[model samples]
Target chain A: MKNNIVEKIWQQHVVHRQAGFPDVLRIDFALLHEVTSAQAFAMIERKNLSVQNPEHFLATIDHSIPTRKNRHEIYDKTAKNQIELLRKNCQNHGIPLCDLDSSHQGIVHVVGPELGITQPGMTLVCGDSHTATHGAFGSLAFGIGTSTLAHVFAAGAILMKQPKVMRVHFNGQLPANTYAKDMIMYLIAQIGIGGATGHVIEYTGEAVTALSMEQRMTLCNMSIECGAIAGLVAPDETTFAYIKDRPYAPKGQQWETAKSYWQSLSSDAGCRYDQTIELDITDLQPQVSWGTNPEQSIAINQVIPFSNKTKESLDYVKLKSAQSIAGLTIDWAFVGSCTNGRIEDLRVVADILAGHKIAKQVTMYIVPGSEQVMHQAQKEGLDTIFTEAGAEFRMPGCSMCLGMNDDKVPPGSRCISSTNRNFIGRQGTGSITHLASPATVAFSALAGFITSSYAEQQPQKEAS
Target chain B: MNTAIKQIKGLCAPMMIDDIDTDIIIPAQYLTQTSKDGYGQYAFSRLKQADADFVLNQQKYQTAKILIAGDNFGCGSSREHAVWAIQELGFQAIIAPSFADIFSNNARKNGLVLIDQPLEICELLAAAAQQNDLIISIDLVNAVFKTDQQTFPFVINPFFQHCITEGQDELDYLCSHLSEIKAHHQNAKGQTIFLAGAGVAQ
Candidate 1:
């Protein structure tokens, strides 16, 4: 059979199959976080089953962990208990956990890639939907619910029916100032948020292949935003180079055998897909979401496109039809999350903030995705540039992305964020979030408005 | 097809909006609850606050056991709290044109049915929900939904069908056969299942 990457991995991992039942698929690895895993652990305990394969499970505290330097002093009693519960559960099962004190501790998706846990040709599952981030390495990865998590803990497999394949081909040389973030935002805005419902999106084409591993991770991270639980990118040399020599990567001879196996995991020529989508982003510019859902977004240069469908979003975002979104005064800017919190995203922000000061009224928060990213940013002096420009460079975690922690956009404030999802009250109750790229959020923080660096007359630091 | 699932009869409510995300279903603040129980009280908190007469809050659906929504129901975040909330709120199944995969899986695992019907069918079921006591019965064995006036056919994955009909936790299904899965893993050669440059069983 000329199978695509998803089919190949699905077939290889089928532990058992029946005539009418879903395939009992083997999960090669599972990632867990604090929020969704507590109940899952309780389920396993009720069933009297320890983790069947301890080596295959990795746990980390991200969603509920406060992104402050003194993260150990968690203030929320419930959040504190959940964090402690994860620590206790990991110890009980002997599963490896990247505790808050560990350098490897960070966002599960970010740490999974950084420590080389995510690899090609495996079926990886996490309790968090952004688990799609690992699919950038050619793995068949998706988010699971707490019940599914318990299933994995007990048997290392779960019943999974195959998802129909949707090939999203991004054909074009991406224009300057546009990024993988913009590419994905454009696709979501073009196709409504539910466009890819029930299908695994396979992002392919020249533009997609050209993205760095980090960038591909960023693009794939938002697959869930458009209702796809998983997304995949066929592995290439870029993927192998990124995975090589990392802490948990295979050693010496095992590396050679692993690479060869990965090489054969790509989609076959003329492989069939249930649906196909094409986007030419050559003319695409930096994009921004002015409304609640990711679909309520448009090019930075364009005004909010108001309509019957958008009336609800417009009322919530306090935006009007045909009004320019630029220079609309933002109270805060956040540049973090599994989506765009890598070293490269920080460098973009630092470059723009080198000699400029953030607007006196604007509050900018910069968070690294992981401790490794935190160290790398400090090594590059990006931390200095950020604080010097009046931005808060906090410790690594999913800080203001979902407002689970203490870092929240005050009620009724407007902020431009680099994180995914602008759901109503996501940042904080009554807080309005304008979703944009890190560069756009950084530049907007400097101007205290919804502006982009691509706009002329913006302050620019000359190349050294 | 007449198996464990005979028929599911319940009063239905209409929540006809797209992208009813987990965040909206149960906000992130409620996520801190380590256990899965109390989220029922806080389901759709934001929308209920926005308007006093949100559909779920209306007196007619006070005992509603079904939800009919637009496309992409439960679209964002993988928090099972959303499913737990709906289940706790006395919903047996949600009828929508489509559903996000994670939410669908979570619902099925928790024994909450998600019936995929086209928009016109959902709209008909929704409009019919205005009058009091709009009871609908789902025949999972035959894969069809029957209402006061219309009988509409639906499609369901056989796995989800079995979960609802059998009404048993999937944990039993997974744990009973654990020995076999572990035995199979030992000889799982040539596959790079070990993560992070970790042991590749070389």
Candidate 2:
């Protein structure tokens, strides 16, 4: 039978398939994070299981770790205990962990791809939902809960039904000033929050091909946001080139074998998908969330949408359907998350803030995704550009994304953020988040409102 | 022999909001605890505090055992704490038109039965529960819910229904096939990095 990329990979790793149950799909790699791994460790312990294949897993700390100047002290007792628990659990289970003390520590998603642990065609699982970010490498990756994580801990497998496939073919030149973040946001808004529920998405066409690997990761990172189990872009030259020399990647002889094997992993010609949605983005605008959810978004030029659901969102966000969001004043600007906290995202924001001072009274937070991102941003002087522009550049973790740590938006303050979700109280209780591309967040922070692009930004008005 | 589900009987409350994501169900601030049991207090803490009349906070529905919601319920984040919170707060099941895939998987593992009803049926259920705390009974084996007004059927994956009803453990089942799993590493070539073409030792 002819098969799409997902089908090809699913068939290969299905170790067990009962009549009516979902396939017992084998997991090639797994990641454990501080917030979700502790309970999973407890579950493993309860089951009297030892780590079956410890070499196949790597653990890291991200969520609930402070990114503040005083991060080393771990002021929150709960955060400190969770981190310590993950450390002890990894040690007890014989799993390799990038503890707070390890240079490898970062957001679990960021750490995986950067160190080359992510590769094409692997079925990867992580306890955190952003594990879909690794699908940028053509892997069949998705997030799982602690039970599934422990299942993999003991069996190196998970029970998952093959999701129906939807091909989101983006067939047009990417409009200037628009990034992969814009493309994904537009797709989610068009499809609603539940648009692709119970589906697996494979991004294709001209627009997808043009995005860099980092950008491809950005496109796939929010797969969970649109309700897809995972998202994929077929591995091509860009994908291969990106993985060629990273630390954990296969070396010389194996690289030859891996490359040839990966080359054959794309969807076979004439294979059928359960559904296909075509999008033309020649004129797509930079997107920003006007309401409280990622799907409550519009093109920078569009008005806050009108609907009963959107009305509820608008009320929560304290906005009207009155005008464009381009000039609505915001209290904070955050430029980081698993969604847009990569090097390319930093470079874009750095360029926007190079000589510009952020607007007065507008707090700006620029957080890298990992320690590697921290050093790379400094090496490229992105940190200097950020600090001089008056944005706070903090140590790397999932800083301000979910804001479980020391960083949080004060209650009732509105923020332009480059994170994925804008769910109620996601950034903090009573705080509001507007999701946008890093470029949009950068320009908006500089202008003190939700600006579409730097070119359309207002001249900074110093507060009297 | 089956570890059959005891009939789950309870009062159902309505939270008809679409996309009631896990973050809202249990906020990230509540997730730092390594213990799973205490999250019930934090469940919907943000919503209940903001709105004085939220359903779960209502005098009538305080002990509600079944919660009904709109489409894509339990969406966002793979945090099992969301499931734990609802279960701890004494919710036995979530009835929805649809659910996010990750949340559904998490729900199954914890015996937090997820019943799939059409949006119209869900709306009906939610609307009825709003007027009065509707007592409902779930029969997982039969795949239907019994309300005082009527009996409505629901769709659930058989595996989940079986596992939740029987309280069966999938880990032990998967562990029974350890040899098969090791062989999969050998056969799933070029698809893994650590194993590469060099398979894992049996």
Candidate 3:
């Protein structure tokens, strides 16, 4: 119990502790976005409860706010109302609000770390599932609902049940063309989507250590896909270096003290986990989810399972067992989401689609995860490359990913997307989604089908 | 307060297929309504497509209060509508190999018990529901479930288990000790007024 960060944090803020249940874990940081926080703040007003700790809570407008313009009235009326509510709530509650025009404004998960608000050895909660993305800094972060969001707004505390721990160890070196997105997809496919259910997964071993802070974030971002409460990578020099110059990071001696504490937060040697999964990073390739769930994935080089071989899975996806995904036509190709919509994702997609044109039948869309990322992509001319390839370069938002905005696929349309979930009607009513990494999505867009870029180009080079 | 007897019990037919997302559970289109009523009728309506073969359309499964689902039962957005729809559809419990983290938490907080069993066990329950009129008795006090095929043990988070067993909402539970809270506030207020303590008053 002493080894748990949740316990440590709980002890610091213990007004009272009851037996037979996990301690009422007091939250230190409550990160919120416009989509969920607007309703939660409304509930708080109705209850007449003031925020207990205003400084600890932060808000940003992300989901519905369009990336193109800063003009508030240009958006849909509902989106305009949501943003207004968030602004009004923050003003009333005395909490910090990172509005669209602010330099720190971005995706809630991205903005938190870049501003150094997401620090090591902290317990962070957000109203979005991708809050696990903050765990890259060695913090315990997970999503909470609007009701719980209201609770945090009022009291800055939450009651939590301790989750069983699972340590995912990835050793050896990663192969070329393999990225953090591929690494997570491989883990989900290997373990199955439910493999880490009811468990908090700790990503460790050499491969995790070798990753940069941004890469580590991408790994933790998709922990929800595997049914894990959250995923963490123990903080190290890389994490410290990333936060050293960030705006909110502690300064001077306080920073040193924070580092010393972070160093001691790692799991002790010989510490036992409820489950341990090992993977060789060298064997991984870019992975794609061929079926509805993230676990129904295969390596870029592999073929979709034959219907007889995947009778159960085929029934769910409505595909024949022998139908190879290679050359299978697609209607739409989308590249963006909290999952793989970062600056690096844009750079990679641009690199792949640089001189190529998208197939006539396939309609492609490239949405940046945030305004900052969109600006960065524009500075690098990635937007031009995407547009030249016959892909629509859309404004930043959670566009086409969850169909929360106007961007959505029509029913029965099959789309290769870089977003997280591929559940039925996730994009729109009856839209079929196949989740993939950015590179796979780009290549599939060019080929007008689910084909691998590496495989298609490899044979041509060898023959030449 | 007296213990309320659970009015509904049975083996629930699998309403939707695998990876049933929050949108399908309750679409965002219906989120405009302020009240949590009338959602049950629209729950899984998109998937039913006016077809009687849809499980929710069946007469026997209409009143079922439990749901048995495949692996990764609720994988998608963190919309609480999914939990609301399940509860509005009258399901008190959902048994699955796994659930989306946020969905499970929302389900528990809203008094819906989400049970995570192994895949094989879920498949067994799903089969039982399909084969015949399967009856499942969920004893909240004992934390045990008896199905036609077998009796299985399901574990709920102790804190949530307490809340559900006591039939107390979280807000009510926290507000129950208002007198003690009020007395403490009064004493602090008096100290501040009298300047009897060094602690600063807001």
**Per-model fnat list:** 0.67, 0.64, 0.19
In candidate 2 the C-alpha lDDT for residue B149 amounts to 76
Question: TM-score for all predictions?
Answer: 0.96, 0.96, 0.85
lDDT of 1: 0.86
Specify the poorest-scoring 10-residue window by lDDT in model 3 chain A: A455-464
Best by TM-score: 2
Which residue pairs in candidate 2 collide? none
Question: What is the C-alpha local distance difference test score of each model?
Answer: 0.86, 0.86, 0.73
Better of 1 and 3 by TM-score: 1
Ranking by TM-score: 2, 1, 3
Q: Tens-digit lDDT track for model 3 on A151-239?
A: 77665566666677888989887777777888898998888766777778889888889888878988999898887888899889999
Q: What is the lDDT of residue A344 in candidate 2?
A: 93
Give DockQ per model, in order. Answer: 0.55, 0.53, 0.21
The per-candidate TM-score of the B chain, in the order shown, comes to 0.88, 0.89, 0.79
- Candidate 2's C-alpha runs over 4 A off are A455-464, B1-3, B189-202
Error of 2 at A374 (Å): 1.3
